[model samples]
Target: MLGQALLMALRALRLNLLRSLLTMLGIVIGVASVVTVLAIGSGAQSQVTRQIRAIGANVLMINPGAARQGGLRLKAGTRATLTEGDVDAILEQVPQVRAAAGSIAGSAQAVRENRNWNTTVNGTTTNHFVVRDWTLSSGRTFNATEEAMAGKVAVLGSVVARELFGTDDPVGAEIRVMNVPFEVVGVLSPKGPDQDDVAFVPLSTAKLRFLGSAGGTARDAVAYILAKAVSDEAMARAKASIEDLLRQRHRIQDDQEDDFKVQDPSAAAEAQRGATRTVAILLTSIAGVSLLVGGISIMNIMIVSVTERTREIGIRRALGARGRDIRLQFLCESLVLCLAGGLVGVVLGATISLTVARSAGWTTVIDPSAVAVAVGFSAITGLFFGLYPAHRAARLDPVEALKAE
Candidate 1:
């Protein structure tokens, strides 16, 4: 009996294939939109997490500033109270700290003969590399002797090397920074586009050559300090220990405000993740509205179908067919239509996602759960919308239906 009803439903839909395809358009669009947005959003979240982790886990940043009332944070280097000595103190006194480095940064024009490029110039010790988990791609970093003697040696990031030297080896090359000559000692491994436009020099060279006496006393001025904890579990303790040590060194009274900020990368990553999730939820909700519109379209079309097949329904009933059988047939037709739309939508959505990723250079992670949810929602929509039309067809009196034209 069920097989016969299903066959009838298929036959009725086949008679008007064009109309049926048009009716499924709304469902296809809704499902495709929802899946595509989710895929893109998930990919963005994952990319952010990877970038943050690339900065190294168990790492903390110490900036010279005070947190003001009303949750406002003063800009980095606002106080200029932290110095190289603070870095040494943190490494020595804080048991949780594994390593620390003092750093300062400024922008300068790099020139190698005719080829010139504007890039960031970073002044830092060897420990800065360790704190950042960065490795040299070629040659060696400056040794302690060069750092202490203030030798004019530099390391170039991938972008800087390509811009100034092209295919030529940058190692053993002399590049002028701010009109001051410095020999390139090494090239750093690429760290994406954002970090590749920078050049690293010994702390003493940067201080003596560029950014002289800008922030504070030359002997005591540094932009910030980067520190690595012994392990992930020690990060909190390291933060607390550094804070206490700085407070004591600065001689701040119990009530006086702290002139520094300690930042945890994990906390920053979590905040970004939370924001991504919120945006995903909002987009999904908007997409759901489209699905609701599709459901209404299905309801309207099913009603019209029942009306057009009134004579067929009456003939079936007159042949001793049960009302339940008529209702199930109509409901099955609606389900099949939605299911087909869902399958098509999945393919469309994946294709769009891949195209966007390739064209825009944005990451896209297609989630299996999202596909499952979309297909499941379509099935539910079919059942919910098909109910009233199926019941209406089942309730019609055979005598009355047979009398209609």
Candidate 2:
């Protein structure tokens, strides 16, 4: 009986195909808007989380002082004031610190025979790889003895390897730093372009041999300390301890803010996710306005539809059809219109998401849940907007409706 009613309603839609399509336009736009906005927002959130996870969980950074000073305001491009001693103090004094290493960076041109490539030269110790979860593909990292001796050896980042050696194995190859030869000990695994555009050497070797001094070039230390916490729960305590220690060590007054800045990865991830969520809500809310307009269009179309179908309603009622039955038939017609439009809109939204992801190079994660919501809302909009027109049709005087026709 329900199937027959549905088929009959579908036949009515086919009879006035253009009218049905025009009526469903609002639903189509409403559903598509909801889906595309949410998909893009969710994709941005996922991309941010993935990048943060790659950096590591429960991570924090203590960068050098703010670019300010008393009577001696430092301009941009000034050297960092952070030193190796500060990192050592954090390792020794901060209770929750599990591992820590200091680092320095400089830009230099690396040359191997006829090949020359511009690269960032990083100066750090062995534990840098361990803390960063880096793997060496060949040879070995410099031992404490080699570091103490300030040996002229280097590690090649993946891109540097490709640039200098092509397909050949670069381990044991000789690469020059500003024309001074240094033996390549190993190649770091591919860890993405940002981390793979550099060369690595012991801090002592880089400062003494390449950078022009034994007591660190320009009498400046370039140690960027990266530390891991003992556990996730201990990260907050670890960060607090490091901050307090640096403040006291720097002799920062209570009224004055600490010069050094420490960043926590887990905390930063949470904050970023929160901001993304807010943006999603704001975007959906604006899309909701489009949906509301769609609902109004549905109501307007249904009212016109009811008038056009009045003669049919009159004939059905004259043949012993109840007012409620007439109402159900009209309601079903509207439901079918919006429901079909919703399905089309879902496909449209998915296509839009996938196209944007491929062309714009954004990460698009389509939430299946969002499809359900959009479709369900479309159905509700159909019923809600169809109600008044259905009621007006049901209350029509059959004889009067027939006589007017």
Candidate 3:
């Protein structure tokens, strides 16, 4: 009986094929929109996390500012401070400090063989490699001897190397910086932008030969220090010690904020992850509304379908079909409509998700869990909205229903 009823329901839809398809249009649009938005949002959030992790999630940055309510806002009369002394103290006093280095950076024109390119010039000690989690890709980083002697040896980033030297090897090559000749000791690995577009030199060399000494008033000058903790267990203590020493040196009151800030990149990453998750959840929730709208469309169309089939219901009853049989037939019709739409919508949504992932370079994770949820909610919609019309169709008296038409 159930098989016959399903066959009949499908036959009804097949008779008006175009109308059925047109009715399902709302469901198609709703599912497609929901899937696309959620997939894109998820991809963006994943990329953000990837970018943040690339910067050494284990590293910590020592910056010159107090942490405010909204985080790192510079206001009028903000204490402008942080010094070489603070960096030295962190290295010498904090036992948890594994490697610590300070840096001052600026940009200048680098000239070689009359070919010039604008590049960032960073000045730092030999320990900078450890503090910044950098390793020599080729040749070598500057040694303590070079730093102490203020040697004019420079390391070229890959882009800088390619720009100036082409196929010729850059090691032992001489590059003029602001007309000051410096020998290239090594070429760094191609790290892309953010890290691989700069030129590096010993702190003392750049300060003496290129830039004049920082007189505490140079806003562009950095007394920035980076330190790696000895172990993950000691990160908290290391941060606290660095902050305390800087605050005491600056002579602030117990309650007054320090003139310096210490940032743990790991903590920043965790916070960013939390924020990304919240945003993804919100976006998914907003998209869920479209599914609800699709369900409403199914309900509206099913009610109209029942109204148009009143004579058919009366005829079935006159032919000796039970009321329960009529109810089951109507209920099965609703299920068949919704389930068919669900199958097509799922295929359509999945196709869009995969296309966006492949063409747009987005990460679309089509979890099996999501598929299950879509199918489950679709059946629930049929059950909830199909009940009333099925009941009304079953309760109609055959003679009365026939005479009314």
Candidate 4:
């Protein structure tokens, strides 16, 4: 009985193919929009996760700033409280800590023979590379002797190398930072666009040269410290130990606020994922409005169909066709229209996603669950909107309908 109703519904729809196609347009656009937005959002979350993991999720960053308070958080490096001693204490006293490194950063103009480019210059110890998990693409990292002697040697990030040397190898090249000449000892592997625009120099050299204090005070202060846990499971212990050691060294009372902040990348990444999910949900809701519009169109068309077939409905009722059968037949027509539109929309959405990924370089991840939801929602919309029209058709008075025409 259900199969016969579906076939009759299809035959009725075939009588006005163009009108049927036009009626399904709204459903198609709504489903496509939902699928595309979800795909892009999921892809962005994945990309963010991958980029954060690349920087080492087990690593923690300690910056000199008080904890955030009432929408007023001190920016990193605003306080000069963090020092080399804090780095040493964390490495020596924290058993869960594997390595720690401190760095101070400032931007400088890098000049070669005839080429010049501005880049971020970081003054860091040898362990900075290890803590960051950064590997050299060519040549080697500055030696301990160079670091200890405050040698004027630099390691170039991939972008710095390309900008300064173009197609030529940057190792063994001499580039002057802030008019102070330094030898380029190595080029680092690519670390995305943001990280690739930086250059690194020995801490001793920067302190002796570019980072001298204005008041002739001790220049042992560092901007931030990077630390790596011995293992993923040890991160919490490492954080706790460092907090305890710094509190003692900084002489902060038990009730006093801390003058520093520690951050975990994993927690930040999770927060980002939450924000992404919220945005995706908001976008899907907007797309749902289109589905609502499509359902209304279906209802209007079904009502017109009932009016035009009033005499036929009466004829069928007089020939022993029950009201329930008439109702089911109309409901099936609505369902078939919506389901067909949903399937086409899925295909269209996927195609558009791939095209955007290729042309705009945006990430898109087409989740199967999103497709399922879109199709299922469309089917439900059909049933909900078609109910009134189906009932109206089923209630027609056979005697009156026959006598009218």
**Cα lDDT for residue 263, model 3?**
85
After TM-score superposition, the amount by which residue 45's alpha carbon in candidate 3 deviates from its true location, in angstroms, is 2.6
Assess the local accuracy of residue 103 in candidate 4 as a C-alpha lDDT between 0 and 100.
86
| lDDT of model number 1 | 0.88
Question: 323-379, model 2: which lDDT tens digit per residue?
Answer: 888788778877888899899888888888899999998878889899899999889
Off by over 4 Å in 4: 1-22, 66-76, 213-217, 282-293, 296-300, 310-332, 343-376, 379-405
Pairs in clash, predicted candidate 3: none
Off by over 4 Å in 3: 1-26, 66-80, 165-172, 189-192, 215-222, 231-233, 253-257, 310-405
Better of 3 and 4 by lDDT: 4
Better of 1 and 2 by lDDT: 1
Off by over 4 Å in 2: 67-72, 75-80, 112-116, 135-142, 165-174, 180-191, 211-220, 251-257, 318-325, 351-362, 391-401
lDDT of each candidate versus the true structure: 0.88, 0.80, 0.75, 0.88
lDDT of 3 at 51: 57
The candidates, ranked best first by TM-score, are: 2, 1, 4, 3
Which ten contiguous residues of candidate 1 have the minimum total lDDT?
211-220
Of candidates 4 and 2, the better by lDDT? 4
